[model samples]
Target: MKITQIEIYAIHLPLIEPFIISYDRYDTMPSIIVKMTTDTGVIGYGESVPDDHVTGESWESTYAVLKHQLAPAVIGQNPMEFEKIHEVMNKVIRDVPAAKAAIDIACFDIAGKTLQVPVYQLIGGRFHKKFPITHVLSIGSPEKMANEAAEHVEMGYRSFKMKVGTEVMKDVERIKAVRERVGADIAIRVDVNQGWVNASTTLRGLRAMRDLDIDWLEQPVKADDIDAMVEIKSKADVSLMIDEGLHGVKEMREIIAKRAADKVNIKLMKCGGIYPAMKLAVMAEMAGIECQVGSMVESSVGSAAGFHVAFSKKNMTSVELTGPLKFSKDIGDLHYEVPFIELNEKPGLGVTVDEAILEELCKFKDVVKEG
Candidate 1:
């Protein structure tokens, strides 16, 4: 059936705890929710979190593209024709992968609902019913971060990713404290978020942490500096994972060719959606690179979309789908219990919106249709 109407909503979801990374601090989740209704009466839902620093998208930009640009492109098209939809979406807009991702997820949801199967099954069938998750310890003082790590460990989380790259000495202290508190078996990962500059500096910092047994380091240098990344990766004592550096399969291939990183972090918003994300996962796997599935700190809708990709893929070595866990009021029915999520049997994403919160928090809502 063809898409009859598309609804877009802008809402700000308060975070359970204000979190800080290398780049900035976030106390709320800014989301653009996309809902598509088909002629057969099946409804599909999707969510997009706009981060100006990460995806180069803001709330106004995401809303404008979805309404003025992407809407007319696929208004009356069949959701099953997702390739055609993606083509039109790209043709109408240049960058704004987050906006395209929202539409892409909604289309996937529609297709899965029509077929009476989970979105993971639609991708490649289920590889595992429950996926492992990694809890994040926001950037803080050494003692505070270490204490947070201990709390998460006590709560049954075996893997933890800490925001680092502010100061080499502080980072070293932070990791050492956490590792010492949690003992040797716990896995600790760090995301620099492009804070460390140049190969020399990155190498120096990584060298300092060499004895700490850090599992992986993410995006130590600026995203576009492939040569610097290559040099740093070669000199680094720990395995390096590229985040902002690789966008999709094309970037993944280039990074692989350059031997820039040991692994790659895949996010639904960065690559557009589940379809392209799956392709990227396979590409990384074939290239002998491990993949980490993450998010832009969105709600359960977007988290569920990420879970589908992570669940269906075998090479995803790490998961940080802690978006729902971060927010105090998640706008969906999906349940999250730290490191593990039990996927429901319902078709599509299997997440229903919390209408009460939607009405209270939604700033804008609009329906798009064919002209």
Candidate 2:
């Protein structure tokens, strides 16, 4: 079927607690939501979490690009021709990955609906019905962080991710406290968000975490410093996972060639959409690199797309789609069991937005009619 209408919503959902990373702090999740309706009466939904520090996108810019560039490009085209839609979007602009991602997700949703199958089946089919989730601990003092880890552990979570890259000594202490609080047999990982800027500092941090049983250290040094990462990876006892450094296939290939990291993390916002996300994941998988699917502060509609892509791959080592858990509201119905996120059996993403809630949280709205 052909596309007939596209609607955009600018929504802001306040987080349960402030989410702190190396670059900044987030008190609310400012997102762009897309709804595309086809002539045959099928509607597909998508969401884009705009973070200037991550994807170089903002809520206002994402909305503008989707409205003035992407929506017009895809309105008359057949949703089934996914490649053609991409071709149209690419020709219109460059570097707006978050904007492109929203349209791409909506198209994939429509594709699954038209084919009468789940998006996972349309992509690579499900390898596991449920996947383990890694809950991230916000940056805080050693004692507070340890308490947070204990709370998740009491809830039956076996895996946790801690935010690091602060003072090396404090980071080390934070790791020690969490490990002690959680006890043995639990998986722990840390992400620096590119906080350690120099090779020496990164090496020091890695050395401090050497005996902590960290599953991996993520983006410790500056994202562009591949030589430093390679040096640290060569020397460190812990394995390394590249996050901010991985942009697309080209960057992934460069990191692979340099032997810069042992694993790669793929997020829909960073890589553009599920299409590019799957491409990078499969490409890394073939090269023997483990993959992890993650998300920004997205609603359920966006995280559901990430869920399908994560389960569709055989080499996905872990997931960090716990964005919904940090917020009190979500667009889709989801079931969470400690470490596992259960998917609904319905087709095509199987998530819907509450209009009343949408209107309540939405700061702006627009409709782009097919011409």
Candidate 3:
């Protein structure tokens, strides 16, 4: 069946609290949702939660590209032709992976629904029925961060990711306090978001936290600085995981060749969508690199897409799709068993989108159909 109409909606979801990292603070998350209707009377949903610092996309830009360029490019195409659809989108526009991701995700949703199988089944059968999710703590004072870690521990979360990269000494203090409060059994990962700025500063921060038992340090330096990553990896005792540095398989190959990082964080928006994400996971597996499926603080529509990827791949050892937990309201149905995200066997993304809530939350809406 061919795609006939595409609907785009821009919505702002209020965060439960301010999500502060090294470079920015977010009190609300802006997301773009896509609805694709097909000739066979099948409808599919997708989401794009772009971060300017990561994907270099914002709500306005993502919405604009979807309405004016990407959506129209995919009209009259078969939703099952993932590669052709991607090629068409790339020809119309370039470097807007988040915008392309919305269409790609909707295609997968359609493919799964048409085939009457879950999205994971379409990729690879489920390897994990349920897995523990990593709870992320925004940047805060030492005591505040420690208290938050303790609170999550009481909630049955065993893994935590802490935001760092503001100040070397204070960042060390933040990790130390959380480690002490949560004890030794709980795993803790640190993300700098390239806040340290240079290899020297990152080495200094790493030295300060040498005794804290960090599971891994993520993107300590800037995204484009492979030399800095190599230097940091050579000097630091902790494992390095690249986040912003990796977008697709090409970056993955370069990192492997340079020995820059021990792991990679794969976000759907960064590499386009599940189609490319699966390719990245397979490439990581072939290269013997561990992968983590990360989120852009999306609602259930996007998080469910991530969940399907995470559950199907064994090399995706870590999961950070906790965005749904941070939002005060969402438009799709996703169940969280405290520390674990459980998936259903229903077709497609297995998510039920509340259209009324979506309409209420939408600040901008547009429909692209054949003229």
lDDT on C-alpha atoms for all candidate structures: 0.86, 0.85, 0.92
> 1-371 in candidate 2: lDDT tens per residue?
89999999999877899998878888888989899999999999888987787788888999999999999888988987877887888899987888888998998898888888888898888887788878899889999999998988888889988988777778889899999999889999999888887779988877776778889989988777878889888888788999888878888989889888899989999888888898898789778999898888688888888988988888987889988888887666655776788776578887766878877889999999976
How would you encode candidate 1's per-residue C-alpha lDDT over 14-74 as one tens digit per residue? Answer: 8989979988888787899998988899999988887787789998899988888887788
Give lDDT tens digits, candidate 3, residues 266-290.
9999999999999999988888889
Which candidate number has the best TM-score?
3
TM-scores of the candidates are: 0.97, 0.97, 0.99
Error of 1 at 21 (Å): 0.8
Clashes of each: 0, 0, 0
Instruction: Quote the lDDT for 243 in model 3.
Output: 96
TM-score of 1: 0.97
Candidate 3 stretches with Cα past 4 Å from truth are none
